[model samples]
Target: MNKLSRLLLTASSIAPVCLTLIFIGWMKDSRSLMIYSAITAFISWGLCWSLMQFAEYKLERSHKIIDSLSPANKEVTNYFLSYLFPLLGTDSIAEKKEYAIFFYLSLLFYICFSENYNFNPLLSLHGYKFYEAEDDTGVGFVLISKEVITDIRNKTFKVVKLTDYTYLHTTDRE
Candidate 1:
């Protein structure tokens, strides 16, 4: 994927935390913080949804032959939990707005620069399923598909490459 697209995926990855911050601000009666966080959360979610739709419709597809494929749904939680460390300090967020801002901005920079865009919750929430696939050479890849692939080992699939290590299945879309 391109840098900007990767950035969007990273932003969406933290959107759930932003939504949580919005709720916290609301419970604390911090209207300004609530509105601000709400705006950011919705924008991240909306843009992510748009980008996924664009990929499903406008991107070109090619076939990939894989020797093995299996469900990878559990991998999503590992990615999701990595963002919760700073949340420990968020209990006093109203008084620590600067710290919270710096914390999240730094998190965003780290994730983007690190290029960990494989397990986005937004992709799962948008009806995509994750799979671990390996080629005949034993090289591994992350594959995203809309359909539930119960048994498709040693099959060729129409897919679009999202990154050097990730692909999106192109068939069975509604």
Candidate 2:
């Protein structure tokens, strides 16, 4: 779906829950609770849009990289990208890529906004690592600092760092 559709979907999905929470707060006459709920809902909406933008940016960059590769490498990359998202079960490369982005963004939304908006840094790191590990084409690059990626890999994967920037190895490489 496009940006506007995604935004509308997210708002529709979140509206009921947000309304319920705010209603409960209103009934209890807890101004603080109602205010917090409204703020949280707004932040969640903004984050979803931001994540979609980031995904689009990454998709464009990956397309450029894929275009620059040799035909043989491009085929290999396309194959991996095509099968990255099992839940979607889609044969279309474009749909698979969109599913992967949605999956990561959903995970990020859960980690950042759910459960009273308590940000779990470790969960976020692990989620990114898991997403990266699943993509054989190395196209699912989660935008994070190099140092953060290095730390997460060292702590979770225990793999030797290959470089300062590009360290995570895809399964198809070895």
Candidate 3:
């Protein structure tokens, strides 16, 4: 997903929880509602920010790895990769379409009914890890796992290494 979509998703998820917490605190005749709300908002914002940073890091890392792979390997890798916050279905229809919807609904359910509403949907989602190889350009290399290598070797996908710099300089240099 784009940065704006991720920010909106995070905000939509966090706002309700913060408001609920603040309301509960107020209902309980807390010593200071303003202070309570302020603290809650701060914590919520911090958590959302941290989550977004982590997601961005993962997405960037995954993209770099995917880009470094052979064309065939890249195709397979892209097929399986799912963004933490997907705006729309890119590849297959079987993939989850409404990540933000599920996240928000799950979050709302937890906030409204559960005692521990600190659940994070991002952490609950599954993710794959690709091996990293240090490179001079800082773009680095990606090493597919043994299983993936084996699959490629078995012609699950035609694996051919291309020497052309077709994807080179696609992104900003600095």
Candidate 4:
């Protein structure tokens, strides 16, 4: 993935938190914050759509047989909670807002530079599932799929490489 896509994916990984921040801004009657948060939410969604398009028309895809798989949805819980749970605490909006901006920017930079498997709930909401998977030769990567992989022993997936450590897995289920 490109730097822009990586940055967008990093932003989108916090999609739920963005929506909540918007609501909090409204609840707190801060018009400036509410408007800004709304804009951020909209842009985040646009980024997701663009990524989908890129994956469909741009990424080189191939079939791969995965021999070992384990669900990795729990990773999102930790990353998400770190961004969200703090909002529920006593910190003021200004403090959290600044911290979040700084944190997200830093995360975007890191993601753009590093090969990492990003577990995103927004992608989950879009019918994607995350898994820790390995091939017969023990090569490992995070698989993002649309189908619930029940049989973990061996499965052939249409894989789109998103990064060195990540793949977008597709299969006909319906």
Better of 2 and 3 by TM-score: 2
Query: How would the candidate models be sorted by lDDT, starting from the highest?
Result: 1, 4, 2, 3
Q: 41-71, model 2: which lDDT tens digit per residue?
A: 6665566445533443432222112111111
Q: Flag regions of model 1 displaced more than 4 Å.
A: 79-86, 172-174
Clashing pairs in 3: none
RMSD of 4: 3.3
Pick the lDDT winner. Answer: 1
lDDT of 1 at 171: 69
lDDT of 3 by residue, 10-83 (tens): 34334434444344334454435435445645655666555444444343331222322331223223222222
In candidate 4, what are the lDDT values of residues 11-75, reduced to their tens digit?
77765666666666667665665666677767887887678667856677787788888888666
lDDT of candidate model 3 versus the reference: 0.33
Q: What global local distance difference test value does model 4 have?
A: 0.68
TM-scores for all candidates? 0.81, 0.29, 0.25, 0.78
Evaluated against the true structure, the overall lDDT of model 1 is 0.73
- Lowest summed lDDT window (length 10), candidate 2: 63-72
Clashing pairs in 2: none
Return the lDDT, model 3, position 89. Answer: 25
- Rank order (by TM-score, best first): 1, 4, 2, 3
